[model samples]
Target: MKGYRISLIATAWLATIGVATAYEIDCPTRINIKSDHPELEATPEGWQVSINKNRSLLLTSLGVYSDEPVKLFELKPEIGIIDGKKHDLTWQINSAYDENGNYVKCSYNGEEVQLAKKIDPSMKSCWAIYANDENQHTTAKLICSTSKLQEVE
Candidate 1:
């Protein structure tokens, strides 16, 4: 009876290892980031950039959040120079209806600050640090490539 039980446990362990390997895959090594024009809300979720007048590309982040954990989302916008062009992004989202059933939009009026220099074939990772802000808000969206996904030290 003891030998039979040990054999059963061994088979279960091997099956578990096989299933884990089957579901594992390597993420991308590099990603191209572009300005999500006409869309001001491009942070860690992904980026929407116009490649042409009628075409656009989208890149979104994937992960899970937990209680009071600190994380950094890195963003690398395409580098270039354009005269009289605006690079600022403004974020706005619709809020939950109030008791009177009125619709409203809350604005995240904070300015987007770049924490690292633009890399052209660049190797440096840009970081978007999220923590306690002046408004006592603890939530915000971030945009970054899969390669930039990492745990904060």
Candidate 2:
């Protein structure tokens, strides 16, 4: 009886340890655009930029919030030259309403900020991710607006 109890306790401890050591995958860097824009495209390296008339601008670097199902709504980190100085514009979606709702709350770096001027869910361009320039000269801009995101393998 004593030997059986010891074995059971050992098994339980091992199971607990295994559970504690389990790892979770971090979000990737990608953006999904639901609206129609002739000038914007996602790069092979997982960044979004504008390609207007053969001219391209490095808009932002995308970061994922979830990895399992790969959602489109995630982080936006932008690095570019503003006013002749390099800047990093990064932002994340802090909160948002359900499918029936129409509000999205976001945070830049650590401070709460406003999104773009327009947010219309019915237009399929409702949802957006925003980030501010590190210089503080600019507030926030819409990185990309999408209605939904597809799961990534």
Candidate 3:
């Protein structure tokens, strides 16, 4: 009877863990940028920004390529996973033209990440970094094709 009780308890515990995990999706590995403004570069020295779905984080680094001083910003955008979660994100690193202004969109999310600066006149498309744990250093990439979000009205 004790063995049966132990087995039942183990089964219940396992079920509870499974259900909890099922509520959260794994972070993505890659994210693709799709935009009319196509002049963008992803380099170590270039600007990179990433958002973590799990940690609810947003990170940005500037002047990564040139001798110019680097700047970093970490903020938390209003993000939540009701159903589909966007672990990967496309970013607006540079702007080429002002026709559409600088904008970036991620998958499964309708909001766009607009640039705060007017550095580039033209729009550029680029991928942002993976929101890795500061200690663990893990990366999440986008699973499929790049997302095309509708412009906010």
- Which candidate tops lDDT? 2
**Candidate 3 deviant stretches above 4 angstroms:** 1-100, 103-115, 136-153
Between candidates 1 and 3, which one is better according to lDDT?
A: 3
lDDT of 3 by residue, 117-139 (tens): 22232223223345567564444
- The prediction achieving the highest TM-score against the true structure is 2
Better-scoring candidate (TM-score), 2 or 3: 2
Residue 152 Cα positional deviation in candidate 1, in Å, after optimal superposition: 33
Model 1: clashing residue pairs? Answer: 43-142, 43-143, 44-142, 44-143
**Residue range 4-111, candidate 2, lDDT tens digits:** 999999999888652211111111222232334455454568666654333212233223232111233443444543223333542222235323322233332232
lDDT values of the candidates? 0.26, 0.33, 0.32
Ranked by TM-score, top first: 2, 3, 1
Model 2 quality (TM-score): 0.22
Model 1, residue 138: C-alpha shift (Å): 27
Ranking by lDDT: 2, 3, 1
